[model samples]
Target: RKQLVYSSCRAESAGKALADVMPDETVHNILLTASLCMGFSAFSYEFMPTGDARRFNYIAMAMTGFCTIGYVSMYNGVGVIEVRGHDVFWMRYLDWAVSTETFLLGLAMLSGADRWDTIFILAMDAIGVLCALVGALIPAVVAPAYLLGAVVFAAYNYRLFGTMQVSADRMGAAVSAKYKRLTTQSMAAWCVYPVVYLFCEMTRALDETTEVALYACCDVIAKCVCCFLLLSQP
Candidate 1:
């Protein structure tokens, strides 16, 4: 369904002037797919009562959708160790997507977290994202920065996940249970992302196909399943 939406939207945009002038226009397809998903999640929000977790879930969907748009160019693990593909793969405005979504998710989780807790998560994720972004854009020259960002991201990502678990305990029963499931499961599922990134970039153990597949699995579990779980809450 996601691919279908991406393809259709990509096709429609192919004839427009931007498509004609821009290089490798198909990469923009992710934005279309994400927008469609965001709209669907927004529409689905109406099914839940006012002020439910579904509202935040809808925002998460949008965040996931929009943030993934930056893929300067996807690296398939089969071959090529060129430097161009690594750093700052934000041709499609990845900086915007990641930074915004990090902010959005931290903000949304505030429904269940204390101000200090939420701010801490936001600060770490923001710093991590910025560092990671810088690292991604310039892996060769500023590899240390990227590595540091990855450390910040990997270390703090788990911390932020734990915060969600703690927050879940304090919320009302319905919200608590859902947040618990969402946070715990999301943390575990995403365990594969960092590993995939590191091994793919370093050892080349997995082909690009496997790398993408792992990422897709993580996304479906983290975003899609979590959204539905939130929708089903109460």
Candidate 2:
């Protein structure tokens, strides 16, 4: 039934321009450029000298690497599904699932979090992303799923600022400061996603162009800018 609906929608839009059926050409171009930039940046991490902090480079690579693939898929007009009248970019959710886990892993490593703490936090993040993905796909479940994702996000932040912050402090003043900065910046960038989803996917308050631009900007900040900051830290 779902496939039938998607096919019918595509068939109906066949008479329309390509942008009307899929993503706008400019947005697709931007996605392609962003993917290439992230791919190159991830590759450049290979030359960094190995050490205790070098592991963070690996985490950054994974985050950007996944995003690179996701954006490239989007550029190629793949991984997008039509639900109702809206185009849902499912690949972004997949990218977030992996990238956010590696992101939290880097933070956990910096804070010296125990294995259990790390596992628990990663689980919460995964559940939150899953909830968001479900909400995007199913119109009826949007409210409940959004609320659930928001709650899970809150819980993740609690653990991050509570236990993770404490552990970072124990590491030393420098580690603690760096951890706080990265966490705060990343969290702020993450908060934009739910807002974008609410407006673009659920409420339809924003148009597709705005949605793509906002998401693209947020991805750059969260993955590229934050990863650069993390790698540049002494």
Candidate 3:
């Protein structure tokens, strides 16, 4: 009887955690989510010391970051419940963030590219998104699509980093250092996203409770934490 009662309580607690948007937030996380998105967007275009040559690129990247909260919210966004608790796991769908970001990020990286670079990046993005969206539509292709995206991403970042070198030269030493830091952090965060997607959305061994918890943690790391890191750079 005691074991049964304990199990039932755990189930209830998990359910409540998924259902509530607030548990113990210092500030409502949804609002914080929005704020971070907007904050990063504003800083990227307005305040950051980036040159005008990459202005369009900055806009594309900023928009990608701004819109990514949609995916985060869909997965399991959090909010403050009271002073002592927090709410999470309100939704699900790990691929949304990854798929969408792949396309936009490619374009953002493509900004200021010459014809050949532009064509290559666009072609790869189209294929990558096709795989991801088709998998999303069919559910059967999701896992394979993620694997394919990893391959494309390796190429994408390689070429993009090469192009960024030109921009880095134009931006100068102090500002270029900041750009390098931001790129490194952003790319590192992106790597975490796919791992979460695989575990939470692809594999079936983990239960919904554990999957959602992992998704929640990784989502914050990839989105919010990266945003602050970008802001902190001089």
Candidate 4:
């Protein structure tokens, strides 16, 4: 009887924790609004001409589509999971895993990077994102996982600045200029993600609502605004 009562109490405590951490109605409304914008962005790509640029348009569409789905899931309380008394939005990581790859694909395509270089960059990106997800889910290994993610991100930057830049430069001054601008914008947006994760997940410096809002801003810039910039280039 004592053991049963203890288990029941723990379960109740967990239930309460989940309830407390879940985004309030305001946050849900924000997510819904973001989802609608992303959905519209994804739909707009359908009219893009089918030619050499079609792949880029499709990649942009996929990135926004994934984000739309992720935001909708979060709004519905579908992908929020409790981890060590905190709520982890696993769908955000899922969104990053696929959407960020599409983002990188656009970069690689724009830079005219060789097959091997493209593969290397994409693989490193995946590793970094996976490390971040693992760190968010498991409290004990948070530091090590974050460090690993950072290291992989550094390798990704090396390729972006060195190999990919070289490829873009060979294309011409115009392409190189465009690639540099877009890459700079992408790096600026991406650098915030780990910092936000560290504060919101590791140190608990920011509350859940702030974390979600910050991430939403980053997502809009990285996926939607960046895609529009890329597609606008001649």
Which digits, one per residue and each the tens of the lDDT, describe model 2 over residues 73-122? 88877788888878888988998999999999999998998888898899
TM-score to true structure, per model: 0.59, 0.88, 0.53, 0.88
Candidate 2 TM-score over all chains jointly:
0.88
Worst 10 residues of 2 by lDDT: 14-23
- Could you say which candidate leads in lDDT? 4
lDDT of 4 by residue, 128-168 (tens): 98998888898888899999999999898899989899999
TM-score of model 4 vs. true structure: 0.88
lDDT of 4 at 120: 93
Q: Once superposed on the true structure, which residue ranges of model 2 sit more than 4 Å away at CA? A: 1-22, 48-51
Lowest lDDT block of 10, candidate 1: 72-81
Residue 160 miss distance in model 2 (angstroms): 0.5
C-alpha RMSD in Å of predicted model 3 compared with the true structure: 10.2
For every model shown, the clashing-pair count is 5, 0, 8, 0
Candidate 1 lDDT, 152-211, residue by residue in tens? 666655655576556666677766666656555655665655565566544456654454
lDDT of each: 0.51, 0.87, 0.52, 0.88
Candidate 1, overall lDDT? 0.51
lDDT of 3 by residue, 34-100 (tens): 4465446545545545354354445444544544554444434442222122222322233333433
Which residue pairs come into collision in candidate 4? none
lDDT of 4 at 37: 84
lDDT of 4: 0.88
Per-residue error (Å), model 1, residue 104: 6.5
